[model samples]
Each structure stands twice: as structure tokens, then as C-alpha cells.
Target: MMRSGPTPDAGDLPFELPRTTPRERARASALARALASAYPDAHCELAYSSPHELLVATILSAQATDVGVNKATPALFARFPTPAAYARATPGEIEPYIKSIGLYRNKAKAIHAAMKDIVERFDGRVPGTMHDLLTLRGVARKTANVVLGNAFGVHVGFVVDTHVQRLATRFGLVAPGASITMIERRLMALFPREEWCILSHRLIWHGRRACKARGAGCADHPVCREFGSACELRISAPSRATGGAPARAKPAALKRSAPRRS
Candidate 1:
């Protein structure tokens, strides 16, 4: 039987040595490969034609769906075609375009403030570096990562949104309640640096399509079978084991049978 250990704190390392085993690394590789194959065309779902547009859309995406942001940005981007244009406008002018989205007032203020910074500090261009991007209002690591990866093709870190966080825990990549910083660090250590940008996208796509928060459709997904033996959905088990009969196991037995990562 696999030994059970104390659940790690939110920011604590999964192990005392701060390292992953060969088995864990192999599983991570397989998981990444599976996700990449499942979502070969995975890209940022936000609709934008420029880095500035992507940045603004990303800012508006907080607590809002990508489709919702897409619906709002067409008119918003048309009016404020550039950072200078947004910088010239008041928050009141921007609010109407995005009022359909949640927290529109705050987002308008942030967009106005961020555009002003871009005009003043970045010479009417979106800053490419993570540090500079963070200086803008309402821009956090996730938004900076979206801009850096999709906009600039730079891979500084993994994007750990709600989908990524939920999927990572489901796959046993990190302990439950791990902070986003810890999750990003764990993912960076697991996958190659070049794969970091698209990795999040693929995971998000999978989370949205198959591995939903409420229920996972793992039975039809072979990649999940390869790397997700511990999934709550129990997809790894054969529908019929012996004598063409459905396999049945007790709840206690199933819990004990779950894989434990080192």
C-alpha cells in the first residue's frame, strides 16, 4: 500500500528535498504530451488584433468569460484604437462599451490608467517585459503571462488561472489549496520552459471541454488514462474486467487503490 503523508501547506514544497522523482517527471511529461496532442491548436481564446488589444481584453477578462470580453471589445477597441486614444479618453467614456461585463466601472478605470501608462512610459506601446507589464493597473502575473506568451512569444512563467489550478490539483500535480505561486512553480519545474506558454492553454481547453470542474469526461480521453490514475472519475478502470462483467470495487477499496505521488 502507498503510504499517506501530511498534506503540505499552501506554499510548502511537496517533498522535503524540494525535488520530483523520475516517476513524477515521466508522468508530467506524458501529461503534457497528451494535452498538447488533444489541443494542437490551443491558443488564447481572447479576441484581439494587437498586443494592446490583448492586454486590454485580458484585463477585462477578470471575473468575466472570454466570449463576454469578445462581445464587449469590438466596440471598445473600435473607439480606442490605440493606447494614445485610450489615454485621451475618460473612464466614463470607456465604461459604456464594456458595461455588459462584470465590474465594468473598475475595468474602465484600469484600462484608462493602463493606457495612460503605456502612452507615457512605453511610448504608446505595450511593455513586453513582465516587470514593466506589472506596473500597469489591474495587470497581474496571469495577465502579464498572457501578454508575454501570446503577444510576445516569451515564456517567463506558467499561467495559473482557475482552470489550470483545478486541473493541476485533479491530476495530483500539486496538493489541494496550493497557492497560485506554488502551482506555477510546480508546473515550471514539471514541464520544459518552451512548453510553458501553450501548456496553460491546452490545459484550459481541456478543462473547458472535458475535465470540467463539476464532472470530468475521462472515459473517452486516453490521455487522461495515461497520466490521471488518481482522477476522481475513475476512468482508468476497465468497464469490464473478467467474464465480461462490469468491475466493481468498494469505496474504501477504491480510495486505497488511488495512486500516491512522492
Candidate 2:
């Protein structure tokens, strides 16, 4: 199901938010504050030495894993180490190395265009500001967040990827169906600006390792303590103990139930 109602910005369709009460907002904020202290070591996993590399790495990371992207980027960077280099290369040349990533064609196009723009406008350097990066192809809020926080040490906004979005809803920090922008806005109202970058990274790590969509480990999780009333464990205990039948059928009991009518 989607989030409850229209957001503060109600111009869009499908209504991107649930109507959060003031009290609920306070509780969510408090929980976020506590979680910040709980997970302080959060950071982006992608490896990159320069701003341009981080930009390209984040773009390639779409629909792909950091480990896989990392494997491909070393050779990719060796060949096209800067925006100028990438801007000059043909898509055919880049595609062979990046073909393993999903949506390689689209990613290649985005990378080529973004590099060309960077070289032409920024003098072969990736821009640090959000507005500037947004102009680059394939640089959505998520990718911009990764580069801003990780590359420039600028925590302009929270990174609300699949993990962040899923865990936020499950933790009651957000309602359902909130857009990434809406979720980030709500979270930003609560978390300190200094911790936004690390918080996103930690949340992503936790979501990947513990709070997975399929089989979350919520029962004994340290973060489970502040889960409030709504957070539910993805795993459940055996049903037999809860006013249900025993696991095994006894042979003697089964035999006694048979009738021996002549």
C-alpha cells in the first residue's frame, strides 16, 4: 500500500506521503537521534580517488553492487582517469568494460554526457554543489547524495536508496510510499546535519546485513530496542506453541482413533 495522504507539496500525483501527526514526528525524531549515536561509523562503500571517479562510480552503481562496480572501475579508471578522458572516449569503448553492470547502455550514455558536461562547464572537474551535479545525466538525488557526502564532505541531504527507504518505513520513521525527496526531507528535520552522510551509510549497511527485506534479524538486533511499537521482526517464532497443535502426530493416538466395526 502507498503512504496515507498527500505531502506538504501536494502538486504531484499518487500523493507522496502519509499525514504525520506532530507527536509522531517528535517520536520519530527522538528515535533518529538515538540511532545516530548507535551507528556512528557509517560511510559510503564505493571506492574512488577523485570527484569525477566518485561521480562515475555512483552512476555505475545503479542496479549494481559496490563490489562488482569496484571490480570494473579499476580498469575503467586506468583507461579514462578524468572527465576529459571519458568525454573524448566513444560509448563502444566504455561499454565493453562495463557490460557486466545492468543497464550498461543507459549508464554509458549518462557517463559520457556527464563527463562531457563536466569537462566543458567545470573545466574537467566535478562540481561540488547539488544544483551543479543535478545537471549531469544519471545524477539523481541518490547519486548526488553519494558524491556530495562521500566526495566533498558536504552532507546536504540524506541518501534514501532502497535500503534507506525500506528500513525507514519499517522503523516508522516514514509512512509508506513517500518519495525519496519526501523521506529525506522528513529525516533531515530530525537528524543533525553533521551526521547525515554517515547516518545514511550506516543505515544502508544495517539494511544490507541485518534488516534485509526477505529475512530481517530484528529479534536480537541492537537497533530493535528503539523500534517503538510498530517495528516488526521479519522472522516469527514457531506457531505450534501459540494455542496451535503439536508438531508431530503420535502413532498410538492415531491408531486409537480407528474404528473396528465388524
Candidate 3:
């Protein structure tokens, strides 16, 4: 994958053991401003109807695309409709639907165990609080954030996936070698709590669509002005710009009726 340069006003990682300068903070702020403006319509792409669905979908999303997870979830949900059903399902049965996703065997075990825990401990309900959600097997901060934001509508923090991590680093949002928790902490300081969830979703969308992992489409990218990387803007020819139609009339052809040049 091709790595983009640091965002405008950004420098080396901040918040190292010794601490960092104001430049990192300014960079984070600038990039956040650009991203917030550029992606006003950002949202979670994973398809789900309920908290339990979100939980299972997020777990299945490990190293897998949201589209892939959506494909497998309908069948998985149909087979194991509830926590009790999932708890009772054998790993062998669950594996087949999600087998195409990354870490299928392990995810099968975790989801099975997690559903069982929800039933036995939480009374067959997905817990809303961070404290209760973390108790499930294979549930990490990333998964917990998904449940909190999508299922409960609680925006506790930003969920740092690979896209978020890479973008944050490029934007100088966090110091190098900083843990996810550290990144979340720094981001919390930069962005309002309300924007956290949407910000992540939008950035991920932008990263996937325009600023792709390999080659980026920097042409007229809204955030380009705020990026530290140097990129050229590519403008299509005027003929191509007119909706693939020819110009109204060629200047040379129009001037043909006029007097010839000396």
C-alpha cells in the first residue's frame, strides 16, 4: 500500500514519552476540520438491524470488508436468530457462513462464547455500557466502539481501525508507536465527542473511495489543501469536461468566415 504524506501543519508523531510540541495539535486540528467538512455524509457501512446484529457483524469484520460481512450475516442471523440460538450453535455450523471472513475458526469460538455470556450474564441482552460490553470474548476497544455507537447511539470514543490509524498517522494526530488507547485519547482532545463516530466513518469512506491505500485520486480532493503531501491536481481537457460532448463551436471554425490574418 502507498502511504500518504503528513497532513498540513503536521510533523513527526507527538505525545511520545517526553511529550510533543504544539505543531502536532495544530495539525490534528486542521486535518479534523478538513475531514469534517469533506465527509458530512459519513456513516457506518456495516449492515445490521439490531445490537446483537452489530455485535456479530463487527466480530465478523475482523480483517474483512464490511461488504463481505454483510453478505454472511443474513444467513448467520437466520440460522441463529437470538443469543440463545447462537449460544447453542456449534462452531462447525457458524463457521460455514463466516468461513470466508478472516479468522473464521477463532471468530466462531468468540462469537459463540460471547453470545453464551450475554445470555447467562446479561440476560440475553447486549450490554450498553463499556464496562459490560468488554467482558465478552474477543471484544476489543474497536468492537466495543462499534456496539456503543451503532447499537446504543452512544458516542464514547472514536473507533481506530486500520484506515483511521493510517489517516491519523498521516495527519499527525498521534505519536508514532502510540497505542490505540493513546490515539483515542489524543483524538478525543482534538474533536468533540459528538463528532467521533461520524468522523471515523467519513474518514474511512474517504480513504477507501478517494484516498485509497494504493494509489490516491488527489484530483480536486477536498482535503488536499490540508494534507502535508505534495500532489498535483489533474484537470481533464475542456472537451472532456463538457459532458463528453464537443464544444459549442470551435473558435478556428467560427473565425473562418472572418478576414484572413496578415
Candidate 4:
């Protein structure tokens, strides 16, 4: 049986505690390998050529799909190709390009303001460090992590978006209702620092293509087949023909326990 103890609430723990046991680390490593093989070309779906473009795209991606962002960015980038151009343009001018995306007004305002900051403070270059990147409008930890990882190849932290959160929970890497920060901490502990960035992409790919939120396609996926039974949310295999839940089977006796707080 898995070990147990009187663990404190997740809120009580430090935001970043790299403290996974040997078995958990091994499991995480294996999961990463399987995902890498399954999705060989998994990468940041946002299309961008420069760091500035990526920063803008990441900001726009908030509460929006990457496909949506990509659809909007071609014209948006054409109009405001450089940080100085974005800084100079008014939000009203920017809004027309990204209007199809959700919260375009607010995102345009943030993009305008962030570019102005880049122009004035960083001399038109997108800041590479998390500290400097966080100062920009609408640039949260998730956005910063995206830019740092993909644009600059810096693995300061992992990106924990909705997909990452759901997949991590489904993989039994974290408990249900765990905060994004706690989930990120658990992932950081489980995987090596270098794999942090790409790991998020792989999880996202799996989440989007297979382990969907409403009806997960978990029947034949290697990682899901191996790990699905222990999922905190109890992901069920879906029927191939109907895309509905398969008929229930007798529950297997629990073997590996759900992850416990250390």
C-alpha cells in the first residue's frame, strides 16, 4: 500500500517544493517519455518569428485558443511588427485586428501598454528574465514561462495552463482541486528542470487531442491505459463508435495509491 500521513493542506506548503519520492520521479519520467514518443512534434502551438511576437501572442492567448490567436496574429503582427510600432498605436487601432478573440479590448489595451513598457524600459526588446517580463501588463507567470521557454530557451519555471492542470491531475501527479502553483510545484519536483518547458507542451497536446475535459479518448492511449485507473478524477474509456462512455466494468482492487502530500 502507498504511504500515508497527516498532511497539511496544500495552501500551507511553499509555492515551490521540489520533493518527489523515488517512485513518483520514476513514474513522471516514464510518463514524459511516453508522451514524447506519442506526440513527437509537440510544441508551442502559437506561431511567431520573434520574441516580441511571441510575447504578444502569449498575452493574446489568455482565455483564448492558440488556433484563435494564430488566426488573429497575422494581421495584427503585420500592423505592429515591432515593439515601437505597437507602443505607438492606440488600443482602438489595435482592437480591430484581434476583435475576434475573447476580451480583445482588454488584451489590446494590455498589449499596447506592454509594448510601450518594452519600448521605454527595455529599449524595444522583450525582456528575457521572468522578473522583467512580469512587469509588463497581462504578462503573468504562465505567459512569462511560455516566452522564456520557447523564445529564449530559459527553463525558469513550467507553464500550468488549464490543459496542464487537468492532465497533471488525471495522471495522478497532483491531487484534485490543487492550485496551479501547487500543481506546478509538483511537476517541478517530478521532472527535471530542463524538461519543464517541453513537458507542458506534451501534456497540452495529450489534453487537447485525447484527454479532453468533457469526453476523454482514453481507450488505447499508452499513458492513460497505464495511469488512468488511479486518476483523481476517474477518467473513463470512451467508446470508439459513439464517443460516449463505455459500459462500466468491475473495479480492479486498488494497487498504487493516489499521490499524497509529503
Candidate 5:
């Protein structure tokens, strides 16, 4: 069943998110300003000229770096330039191009199946809406958020990648241990609806460069000084902010799954 009519700025938000207090919104606003100032030009790093290319790149990006996905994608894109092109090929043909990426075999299947479905159902165009996009084989809420925000200019939800999740907890934008679904809704409630797209990019930018998951890269920055509580969380409760590092950081809560036709 497609999500009909108005879609909330929280990915149809499968879970109920707690409402934000005015104080929480004020703090979140300040953090948003700090991020925007720091990363004024933040944007999706996955290089693509079209929506379908972006979709495939984001799929391959699971457990793979954007750089790695970019490297593999040039040849792949040149070969299968459109949904029709990929739809014509078997998953085996798609495999060779993306073989260097993690889980190539499975990704090949996802890409092939998704593209084939697009051709058969969506008139070979990448469907821009969340419900339609989620029906594609490889897409989940996060991947859909990337495609929706960056490709289609539809910011229906916040993206919660590892960097975003870690930084959110560290910055106190979210408490430790919120599920990804809940975190997306919480961020949505805190930020202005129009800011959702750039907001995620900015968070990712700062997450990569400054307020890293392990520890602060440079604690002197004002945002970190005010919001950088992960260090304290680690000191007091090892499992909270740090995910008890020295051991492995907990694997991200999201996984690529067949979408719920709910």
C-alpha cells in the first residue's frame, strides 16, 4: 500500500516519535545554526548526474565508502545509463562493474531488480515519492532520504547515518540509544521542515571533520564545548554515547531489507 496523500517530514515515520519541547527546539536550533555555519556548502558526496545513478550509488554505499562507490559507479553508469539499460541486463552482468564494492553479488541483484521494476512500473523514471521509492528492492528509509533530499529536492525525512547518529547523541540532539526511526522523527520535529535536506548534510560534514564518534577532533570549537557531551557519557556510562568503544562500535541499527508493504 502506498503512503497516500501528505507524507510527514519523518519518512512515514513507522514509529511514534516524542514531541519536542520549546526548550528542546531552541537547543536543536542552536545546534543547527552551528552546523550550517561550519559547513556552509555541505552536500551529498556521492557523485552522480541523475537520480537513478544516485539510487544505485547509495545502495552500493552500504558498508562501502562514498569514494569507493564513486570509483565503481563511473563504469557502471556509462554502461547502464538508464533504467531501461539496467532492466535489460541480468544481475550477473551488473556484478562485474561493482565487484570491488562490498557485497557486490547482492548489490548486483538489488540494482538489477530495482531497475527492472522501475522500467516495468514507473515508466523508467526514478519515482520521487517515498512510497513509490521504498518499493524498489534496495531502498530503505535512509537510502530513500538520500535520493529524495539530494536528487528530487523532496525532504520528507532526516537522514540518520552512523555519523549523524553518533554526532546526535554526542551533541545532545538525541539521547543515547534511540532507534534510527525515532531519531529521524525527533530531528524532524526539532528543525524547520525546509531545512531537513541541508541539515543532514551539515551534520554529516561536521561528523566527518570535527565531532567524530570516538572523541572530539578539536574540542576548542564552540559547538563541541557546549554540546560535546559524548566524552562525559563514555566516562559515566560506557555503552551510552561511545557505544563502549575499545570494543567495536555497535553496528548501525539499519539494514537493507525488503520494504514492508504495510
Candidate 6:
């Protein structure tokens, strides 16, 4: 899947990006603008008071909802206000507060280990750089991008969560069947560097509110019509696979004036 795609530039470093046409990039810009106007105040939904708290919440957010994470974090953050505090407690000590979240045991372990790493390796401060952030337990490119962009104001890369991944293709911003890695690069190539963080926020809001994966009724929404006609064309849109890339529905599925309702 990682066919050498121009060794991605510094804008999207650490991964490869398939070459894009100027027209495609323009469409992406238009989409970003539409989302900006539609969701002017979009932001990271995860609640946190500090960089280390954000890092811990993000780790707990894997395969979990922000609502669930937020519900758990208030008490947890109040209890262990700093990485040094978390470092002193065992994972078991952190579990009760987060027990409401899915996979609480594992998340507690990851949070404890990551905090210990920060205290020992990074001097009790959350590492701001992507490379250093990834060294933490339970961190990957997505979590690293989240912490870097939101916590540190360093937009080195785009965050490719479920919403971003789905909305990217539904808006026709990337090639059909593109991998998540590829979708992220295509987005990087298309949008301005500074827009990466807030753009993700707005797009995620759109996905959740209008262009939902199930029972969506926004086919005629102005933004969807102008930027994401594919969102309405569910028959031809990408399946909810790993990358959220469209599957290119069979020709038989395209013979319709109105999309079939779910």
C-alpha cells in the first residue's frame, strides 16, 4: 500500500503523498472555507487544562468517545494534576476514575506509563515535538498530531481521526480507495499549513452534525451540495473501511436521480 509516492515533502513529512492536480487542491481549499464558515468555532472536543492532561485524555480516547473521556477526566485530572502526580500512582490507582470509559484498564495503564515516561524522560513536561511525543506509550501518528497541534500550537501534520478520514473522501478530496495515510497527505497538500488543526475541528463537526455515517439528511445542505456531493451519493460513496476511502459503487447503483435513503 505504501508505494513510493514522492517521499512526501516537509509539509507532510514522515510519510508519502500521491501527486495531486491543481484542480483537486483548489476543491480542497473551497471545502475548507465552506467548513470554516459553517463551523466558525470548531475546536478540540476533548476537555483538558494542560498539555499533559490533553495527552492523557487523547490516550484514553482511543476507541472511545470524547463525551465518555470528558466525563472521566474531570475527577482524574483533579486527582492527578500533573505528569509527576500520575507518575507517582500505579495504573491501578488511576483506574477507578476512568472506569466508566471503555477499556479503562488498558487506558489507565497507558496513561500511567506515558506519564512516567514524561516525568523520567522529558522532565515532567509533555514533549512538544512529534518524534518525542511518539515515544510515549499508546501514542501513534494521530495522537501525536492531536497533542502537537492542539496542545502545543505546532501544526506539523493533520490529524486523521474517524471524522477527518470519512469527510475527506465524502468531499471528494482524495482518490477513491485511498488509504488513511494517503488521505492525510492529500489533505496536507490541499489545505494551508495553518488551517490543518482548525480545519480538522470544523470537518469533524460537519461529519457528526450533518454528513453522518447513518441516517444523514443533509444531501441538500448548501455546503454538501457545493463541496461534498459524494456525501449524498451514498451508493457511490466509500464504504466505512479502514481509510474511509470510497469504494466506487457499481454502475448499477448509480442509475438514480435521488439517493436511496438509509
Whole-structure CA lDDT of model 3: 0.67
Residues 71-160 of candidate 2: C-alpha lDDT, one tens digit per residue: 999889999988998899977778987988888988888999999999899898899998899998768978888899988998777788
The residue pairs found clashing in candidate 2 are none
**Model 1 clashing residue pairs (backbone):** none
Supply every candidate's count of residue pairs whose N, Cα or C atoms clash at under 3 angstroms. 0, 0, 2, 0, 0, 2
RMSD of model 2, in Å? Answer: 13.3
Please estimate how well model 4 matches the true structure, expressed as its whole-model Cα lDDT: 0.76
Which pairs, if any, clash in model 4? none
For model 4, residues 1-262, the per-residue Cα lDDT tens digits are: 3332111233333353634455566677898999999998999999999999999999888888899999999999999999999988999999999999999999999999999999999989999998999998778888999999999998777899887877776676765566787678777767777898999999998877876664335656777777653322433343222112121222332333332110
Candidate 3 TM-score versus the reference = 0.75
> What ranges in model 3 sit over 4 Å off?
1-30, 230-262
Q: Give the poorly placed runs of model 2, Cα more than 4 Å off.
A: 1-39, 228-262
Per-residue CA lDDT of candidate 5, range 1-262, in tens?
2111112455555554455555556667888898788888999999999999999998899878788898999999999999999999999999999999989999999999999989999999999999999999888999999999999998788898987877666665565566787578667777887898899988887767776655635467676666554344221223222222111222222222232100
Which pairs of residues clash in candidate 6, taking residues 3 or more apart in a chain or in different chains?
238-246, 238-247
Of candidates 6 and 3, the better by lDDT:
6
Name the candidate, 1 or 3, with the larger TM-score value. 1
Candidate 3: residue 29 Cα off by (Å): 4.9
Model 5 CA deviation exceeding 4 Å by range = 1-17, 233-262
TM-score of 2: 0.75
Who wins the lDDT comparison?
4
lDDT, residue 146, candidate 2: 88
Top candidate (TM-score): 6
RMSD of each: 9.5, 13.3, 15.5, 9.3, 8.7, 6.0
